[model samples]
Target: MPSPAFTDIQLPAPVLKGRGAIGASDNRYELLSRVALDDGWSQEEQPPPRTEVSFDTSKSIIVQQTALDLPFRQSLNIYRGCEHGCAYCFARPTHAYWGLAPGLDFETKLIAKPDAPRLLTEALRKKSYKVAPLAIGTNTDPYQPIERSLGLMRQVLEVLRDFQHPVGITTKAALITRDLDILAPMAAQNLVRVAISVTTLDRDLARLLEPRAPTPARRIEAIRQLSDAGVPVAVFASPMIPGLNDHELEAILEAAAQAGARTASAILIRLPMEVAPLMEAWLREHRPQRAERVLSLIRQCREGQLYKAKPGERFRGTGPVADMIGQRLRLARTRYGLAAPAWELDCTRFAPPPTLGDQFTLFS
Candidate 1:
């Protein structure tokens, strides 16, 4: 069997983590797979539970010049390689750029920007800095489990609060609830909005889909908590996998609405590079019967391919199947009374920390 093939499935329990886990990184242009010939392996051979893995990040926390399509032109990532282990994350391929496998390594071998708040403060203090609502948790989650100790996200929020910077955040972790004190005050000034990404309502399915994320019930509760605190909250029913969790779209939206989510959004599944093989392996293991059907539907939108990376076409696929998903999402949002919130965050309230130029003027 070809090493790069998505059909090269392997069980992900102890074998995949230890012996069978050896594989090529994405740089090799081959999605490697391992086979274990051990006999008497039971279905109970559950994968060893994941543990914390940490790495260091450089001083630059803010990524400037984001994609034009994004609502915010700048982004701040507190961490790289999310601990959530979401199977369908397009961000997986990014880990490969660090010479790491986008599979288990991307989830377990996490990285943190301890200097994020300091760097953000310095950046905000720059004379030429312009204020736009900075997007948080865009490329990777800021509220992953390790954040409990690191507190990098909280630190960044503190800087934002001090400077009155408008910011947007998205996370699947219920940890966001812990910061309501800061967020509520920021919300009062129209400086913050948050979107909680709830992938599936089924507890078992959520476990398989986003292994480390907070449960669906907890995410709903987070929405209610954030809304109750006077913070504007939105729900993201994202990466609607075809023939898979797509059926849960309306349910997730309705649940979020009932829980006080003011707006809702979703994206079609996007499997790129090593992510394609990784997601396929999980599908085969967990949803064998519908695996091929789901892949077929994905290809239907991707011009008979697993994925197309074009900016416009990547988020939502093109063909009839993709079209139907988009239309269904619109109808569901309307039916649930969800739309972009009426109020706006004020950029004019921005007060960048005093810069060197200000000091020079003071002296002159």
Candidate 2:
């Protein structure tokens, strides 16, 4: 039988307990180092260090179609591997496809699309490009910490604004507030909407779960600022961890509603692929005492499994706990009059960016 430490071995990425890469065809390595103990010995290994980066070249800016039944159809990810480094991020497993670990690598290795604006403009100029709401920061946050230095997301938004195209954004960064000049006008025409994801209101838990992201208070302020500026602001209490953060659901919704959010939504925690191990490790390291209970509750919702990929049940598991959370969300939303978005963004007015060649053709 596998050891107790190996109970949850089905991780998305292989966790190398020692400092060496595992080869598919080789197994001649010696046993990893271990320490003696009174009853049994203990083993310790150092996790890999973080990696820094400059930019990531993206051939295409638009990620065309996704199978998920989300509201938006088309999406754009300005970056990969969020620097916000939320321990429970569902997007972490995506890094493994790039030959990187979903643990520190997902948080450290940065990817930016410097050509995002140019590519977006080019795509919009296409005759076949249908005009629907383009979503930003759907996969990874466009306004992650790197935005402060790179300013890539701002450029993409500028392109969208110039084209008069409809866009939707979801982010936890306060940086979006800096673009009020553009957002306020788009919002006036009902051309844009934004959702701020706030996981918990506890500053300490926020730090441990989402270390680099803005504080809960700052996210609330973001909603307030956007709403006051005529922008439709919504709150997303995402990935409602069962034992870890379920208790904060009502409190989070109340705080966001007070901050001017007119709509609210929630998603149960999803552990796809390698995110399970990465998150389990985080729980063991940060909240050791409650780790078992947390895992148990998560499995209870996931049908006795740590995760379930069923299309209908993935986003919000079906169980008594998940049902209770959904009920509470509905009650909170009703109480605050946040059942629907303050306004709907207009897509009928979407106009493609004009090209120099098109300008001459127009005059001809």
Candidate 3:
């Protein structure tokens, strides 16, 4: 009898550190796959354990902006990387600049902007500063799970309220509902609006795709609560994947409408740089069976490429599948009475608080 052949055992992927980890200023980002060596066989491997959280404070709190196409001319990010860990997140590539993987590391390694409120206040006091609807969560989410304890978002909102600044917030965290006290009064002045990103209503799919986010039902409930509080709330069926969650477009809109969302928006999936491989790995891990089909459909929508970065076509892709999604989204919007009305935040109400110097001048 032939000697029993032993299969090579594979080692798990090693956790990266320093330049290898995300947000590392170093140029080298690395990954090591483990494999077992066996005669006439390859090593077997196991998935690495989940990444852990680490943080650093940013020097400046308010990030200035000159971009024109985006809705907000200026924005703030309370945190870098997000704990919510939505696999299809477009912001993931930003981690590469920090030398981190857009994969697990992007979600696990987070940085908080504790001084955001003060920075915003100072920025607003500048003579060159013009009042516009400042957007929060423009890059990474401001209300990610960590915010509950950090209270950074709450503090930023308090600053916005104090200055009577016009603002817009986009988030998936249901915790935004906790600030109903501030949001409601701001809404009364048309100074604030909220957009909730709802990708799917299927609980299991959402669990696998979003992982750490609030459940789909809870997101809808948050929409309802925001609307009930008279806050102008919208549901964004954003980052719609071609073969994955795209089919739920109409259902998501209808559900959101029922939950009292007056506006609906969508963005085609974006797989910029490292986000492609990360998302592909996610699909293989959590959606292995449908992974191939899903990837193929994405390529079809992206004009045979993994992504299209063209300014006009970036948010909405091209091709037959993209056309279908557009039609479905338009129909849903019309059928559910959702409208793309302007948020039109009030800049007129913006009034800087009295500075000590200003008070002295006034008294003198």
| Each prediction's TM-score versus the true structure | 0.87, 0.85, 0.86
Q: Candidate 2 residues 163-212, lDDT tens each?
A: 88989999998889999999999988888999999999999888778878
User: Highest lDDT among the candidates is held by which one?
Assistant: 1
- Estimate candidate 1's RMSD in Å: 5.1
For model 1 the TM-score comes to 0.87
Instruction: Tell me each candidate's RMSD, in Å, in order.
Output: 5.1, 6.4, 4.8
Ranking the candidates on TM-score from highest down gives 1, 3, 2
lDDT of 2: 0.80
TM-score of 3: 0.86
**Please, what is the whole-model Cα lDDT of each candidate in the order they appear?**
0.82, 0.80, 0.80
Worst 10 residues of 1 by lDDT: 15-24
- Per-residue C-alpha lDDT of model 1 across residues 63-119, encoded as one tens digit per residue: 787465666788888887887888888898888767677877777777787888888
Model 1 clash pairs are: 13-47
lDDT by residue for model 3 (308-335), tens = 7877788888999888899898889999
Kindly indicate the candidate among 2 and 3 with the higher TM-score. Answer: 3
Off by over 4 Å in 3: 1-57, 66-68, 356-364
Cα lDDT of candidate 3 equals 0.80
